[model samples]
Structure formats: C-alpha cells, structure tokens
Target: MTQTLEVTQAAEVTQAAEVTQAVERPLQTAKPALGRGLLLLMSVATGLSVAGNYFAQPLLDLMGRELRLSTTMAALIVTAAQVGYALGLMLLVPLGDLVERRRLAVSLFGATAAFLVLTALAPNGSILLLGTALTALTSVAAQVVVPYAVTLAAPEQRGRVVGTVMTGLLLGALLARTASGALSELGGWRTVYWVNAVLMIVVAVLLRRHLPKLHTPAGLRYPALLRSTFALFRTEPLLRWRAGIAALSLASFNVLWTAVTFLLAGTYGWSEGAIGLFGLVGVAGALSTLAAGRLADRGFVQWLTGAGTALLALSWLAVGAGGASMWWLIGGVLVLNVAQSSLLNANQNVIYALRPEIRNRLNSAFMTAFFAGGATGSALTSIVWVSAGWTGVSVLGGSLATGTFVLWVLERVRTHA
Candidate 1:
C-alpha cells in the first residue's frame, strides 16, 4: 500500500515537471540572430513611417498661408495628424498579429505614398487636412515594424533590437522637420509631401525585400483583436500601469517642445531656420535609447525608470530657467530628451516582456495611450502659453513631470509591497 501511494505521488510530480519544461522550451529554443542589415532597414522603415505625422509641424506657417487659414484653424492640421495616428494605433496596428507583418508594413507604406500625393496636390485647406489625416492613419507602419522586430529577436536581445529601431524612429521625427523646412524653402511646403511620396514607395520596396515573416498563430478576427486590446487594460495590470507612465512622460515631453517654439520666436526673436535647429539638439537624447535598451537587458529596469522620471522632474527646473538664459534652455532640453527617451524605452521593455504573443496589440494600446497624452499636452500648452507665457508653461510642464515621478515611486512601492 505504501509503495503504491509513493508511485502515484511520483507520477504527479513528473507530470508537473513536464508542464514546466514544455512552457520554458520555447524561450530556451534558439532564435535566429537578426542581421545588422535587417536592423538598419527596419530602423529606416520605422523612421519614414513616423515622419508622415511630423512633416507638417515646421511647415505649418507655410501651409496656413497657402490654405488661407486663421491661426487657430491652421493648428488643426497638426492636431488632425496626431488624432489620425492615435486612431491608427488603436485600429490598425493590431492587424500585425492577424496578418503577415511584412505585407502589412509594405501595404501601409504604399497607402501612405498615395495619401502623401493627395496632400501634395491638395488645392485647399480641407483637402490637405484630409490627406494629412489619411497619411498618418496608414503610417502606423512604424508601430507595425517595431513589434515585428521584437518577435524576430531572441528573447534575450529584444531590448537592444527595440532600442535600435527606436533610434531611427526618433531620428526620423527630428530630421523630418529639418528636411521639410529645407524642401519648403527650396520649393514649397507641398514639395515636402511630394518628396515623401516617392520616398515612401522606396521604403516599402526595401521593407518588402527584407522584412522577415514570423510564424505566429492565425490572428483573431479584427473586432476581437481590438476588443482584446481594451480588455488588456482590465486584465493586465502591468500594461495599464506602463501605458499610464508612457502617457504622462509623453505629455511632459510634448509640453516642452510645444512651448519652446514660442519661447524662441517671442522672447529671442529667432528665425524659423534657427528654431528648426533645436530639433537637432534633441537627437542626442534619441541616440541614448540604444544604451537604455542594453541596460534593460542587464536588469535593474525599475531603477533605470526611477532615475529617468526623477531627471524628467529635475529637467523642468532648468527649463523653467530658460526664460532667462539660452544656455539653461539648451542644457535643459538635452536632459529632458535623455530622461524621456530612457523612461519610454524602459516602459516598453517591461510591457513587451509581459505577454509575448500579443505584442502588437500591447503596443497598439501603449502607443494609443501615449499619443492621447501628446494630444493633451499640445492642447494644454497652447492655452498655457497664451495665459501665462513661458513661465506658466514651465510650471505646467514641471508639474506634469513631478506627477510622473510620484506615479513611478508609487508603482515601485506597490510592486515591492
């Protein structure tokens, strides 16, 4: 009787062990190494995709003048693009899990090319706004490429791979304005759209030739996939928390950039050309995301995030002083970029680690939250800049940063508890 009982207990233990091994085997299995060429190509694809939303920012004045728009009405062009991107993040990015990612990405670039032409050819403000919105609506191609990159990378290397791609994404945002400014100066604002139209086709061809096709389960139907994303907010605590942090961090980042333009134009009387160069300054911070990605792999994610949020708060103090000193503003914006990039990378690392299969959907949710915050910050800064000026804008941004730190601390405490 004793021997029979012992044999049964041993069988139960073996079954549990089998279950554990089955789960870990996938993570332990060798994943193909991502080639440097693929990484570079992916980076460029992501950058070009994201550049669609930002191209109009520097060209807003030119566009407004051409479209016969009032100042208040002209700003909507940028807002329309932002809103379109947020919508795409929610509606379109989830399709990555359902379809072949390479196809989806290539298709997005092609569609974006069409819309860019529409924007370039727009005869009036309304049509131009529609074209810009459609371009951004399809340009969530960057979001598609990012999660696809994560899937191709071995589990251990996901952080570094994601970081490298993000560098391109950030650089695209930084450089697009400069390029738009130059193109607009040489030709007209419409020239920027025409150039990007051709560029998007080139990008699509490059991506189609190089982007890897991963073997994922056939994805859910569209509605279920999207429904699953919002359900994630309820089901996954980490996703919700990370999304909030991203939103807050992005909100603070937007507030600074939005208000800084006013400070340069109003206080320093800087030309549009000079004002455009500051985007270059922020590129330094974007480059640091690669290091931040490596650090995420080394562990200490929480520490890195905590430090970033703290710096974000502290950077605001320097930014607040920018009203008095140009050096302070330069130094502060650089610090702000570092803090923002690092924190965002850390947040993605954490969320991406949570549920591997639905990375695109998870990303869709995270980025949607992020853009929503950006839209908020843009709207808020416009109001504050008018009522309180630079000082008021600084205080508002600082308070948002401080709130970000507090949220980070509370999360850490709660996680530990």
Candidate 2:
C-alpha cells in the first residue's frame, strides 16, 4: 500500500510539469497579434485632439477682422498653434514611455480644455494667440496615445493599425473647419471652442477607465531618450528623406488654405457658411486614408506615397486655374485634401513599420517636421500672397508639391538600392 501511494504522487507531479511546459511553448510560438480595441480608443482620442487643433482654421478671417489684426498677424494665431504642437511633440511625447500615460493623457486633456476656455475669454489678439498655442500643445494627447496603440499591435499589423487610427485623425482635421464655421454661424467662434471643451472632457473620462496598461522600458535615462530621437534623424536615412517630403507637401497644403480664407472672403464674397460646406466635400477624399493605410500595410509605401505626391501637384494646379470659380475651387479643394491625407497617412504608416520599441520618440521626430513645415508654410504664405496674389500662391503651392515628388523618387531609389 505504501509503494502504490508513492507511485500515484510521482505520476501527478509529472503531469503538472507537462501542463506547465505546454503553456510555455505556446507563449514562445509566433502568433498574429490582434489589437483592434486599442486602435478604436486611439482613433477616438486622435479625432478629438485634431478637432481642437483646427477649430480656428475656417474662422480665421472672421476672428482676425473682428479682432483688428493685420493679415500676417492674424495668420500667426494659426501658426502659433502649429508651433506649440511641434514643441509638445518634441518635449512631451517622449515622456509617454517615462510616465504613467493614462494619468498624463487625462491631465493634458484637462489642461487643453482650460486653455480653450481661456481662448474664448481672451480680450485681445495677443491673449488669444497665447491661448491658442496652449490649446494646441494640449492636443498632443493623440501623439502619445497613437504610438502606444502601435506598440500593442503585431509587427505585421502596425501599418493597418496606425492607418485605422489616422482615419479618425484625417476626419477630425477635415471636419473641424466645417464644424467651426457652422458653429460660428450659429453662435460665433467662441461657441466652437466652448463645445469642444466639453467634448474633450468626456473623452478624457472614458480613456481614464478603459485604456489598457502599456509597458515602457525601464531605466532609460533622459540623455538616452534624447539621443534615441536624434539618432533617428542621423541614421534612418529613409525616415529623414521621407520626413522632408512630408514637410514640403504639408507646406504647400497650408499655404493654399491659409491664404484661401482671405481670397474667398475678400475677393469672391463667399460667406463663412458657404465655405464651410466645401469642407464637407473634402470629407470624401479624407475617407481614403483607410485605403492608403491598408496599401502601406501591403508593402506599397513607395508607390502610394509617390502617387499621392503627384496628386498634390495636380490638385494645386487645378485650384490655381479655378480661382474664384466656386465649383472648380471646391473640386480642387476636395482633391487637395484627399491627396494630402493619403500622403500624410502613407508617411505615418511607413514610419510605424520601422520603430516598434521607440514609437513615441519616432512619432515626435516625424510630427515635429510635419508641424514645422506647416509653420514655415503659414509664415511665408502671407508674404507670397501680398507680393503676388492667388495665382502666385498657386505657383508656390504647385512648385512645393513638385518638390515632394522629387523627394519621393529619391526615397524609392534609396530603398531599392
């Protein structure tokens, strides 16, 4: 009886060891990573963040005229937001890995909400500019949150995941002008900010409870993190040149739209309400971001990016020809926005493929160039418009698009070589 009891105990221990080994083997096996929930959350957050950044675009003319700002000075308000966003990407996004992201996200949302209120209440242009910058800086919530989503996805699925989230981002950027214009018509520009303030707060609350815990590497010193970001620029030649293409393309995009407000209102006598309706049309093109993203996932980054850049050049030419012809202008606007969205998504999707471990830092480097190009575009647009006119603006816009095409060709050659 004693020998039989000992034999049963030994068999039970052996079975338990087999079960443990089975569990460990599956963990080690390669499997497809799925992260749709993380993508959904990122999309929602990104949409909200983009909406906040662009509420001022369509209303710039109205606000500037009402506030007694010079054209260039008024333009600065928009540029300031871009500058602030760039700063946030550089300094704060890297903190995603170093800090508790959920807490940081909530705090930034609250801070941005407060600043929007400040923007609504500001008495003068300078105060309004400062408030706008603060609001944009707060919108970096997307930058932090999106890259975290990329980390959760499988390496193979990163492009699709990033593209899916960016669809929300593109929608937000395109819709913001429409929402702002329609809201401003009903209750003035201040009302637009007021409404978004509440929306952001709600998004913050949802994220706080629902976001999954993410892992960040431990023991990364500040200098090390900074060095990693810098290294991307130095070592990643594709990232470097791709970013330049993105910058040039973005510059032309901003130049056209920033100057269009004045031309549409002053030259064509178009109402803000009418202009806002055009943004709705642009949504058709904006929706293509999903397709662009999926294509990037299929290893067609160079082709998608190259085609998108060519589209940008054509759209600019169309807009230049159609100046003041409402239908022509509207058609060009739709094409331009669509092509730009595709190009932007293509760049982002390709970058996501390169860096999984340092997504935040990589994103910061990419977006910094994106916004910096936007800032440079906005700043130079007024000068070009004043010196030459809508036609001149079109020339510059088209030429920049052409430059992006050259950059794309360079990227492809380098990649194949």
Q: TM-score each candidate.
A: 0.91, 0.84
Alpha-carbon lDDT, every model: 0.86, 0.79
Estimate, for each residue in 1-417, the C-alpha lDDT of model 2 and write its tens digit: 999999999999998787555433432331233346656766977887878788887788889877888898788887788878887888778777566666777788888888989999878899999999998887898888777666666655666777788778778887888888888989988999999888888888877767655545424787677777867899888789878998998898988778887777778887877766655776776678777777877888777888899999999877987676777777888888888888988888777667555667788888888878877887788899999999889998999889999998887788789
lDDT of 2: 0.79
Number of the top-ranking candidate, with lDDT as the measure: 1
Residue-wise lDDT of candidate 1 within 140-194, one digit each (tens)? 9999888878777876777788899999999999899999999898999998888
Error of 2 at 396 (Å): 1.0
Give Cα distance to truth, residue 80, candidate 1, Å. Answer: 1.1
Pairs of residues clashing in candidate 2: none
- Model 1 residue 149 CA deviation (Å) reads 0.6
Q: Which candidate number has the best TM-score? A: 1
TM-score of 1: 0.91
Task: State how far residue 321 of model 2 sits from its true place (Å).
Answer: 1.6
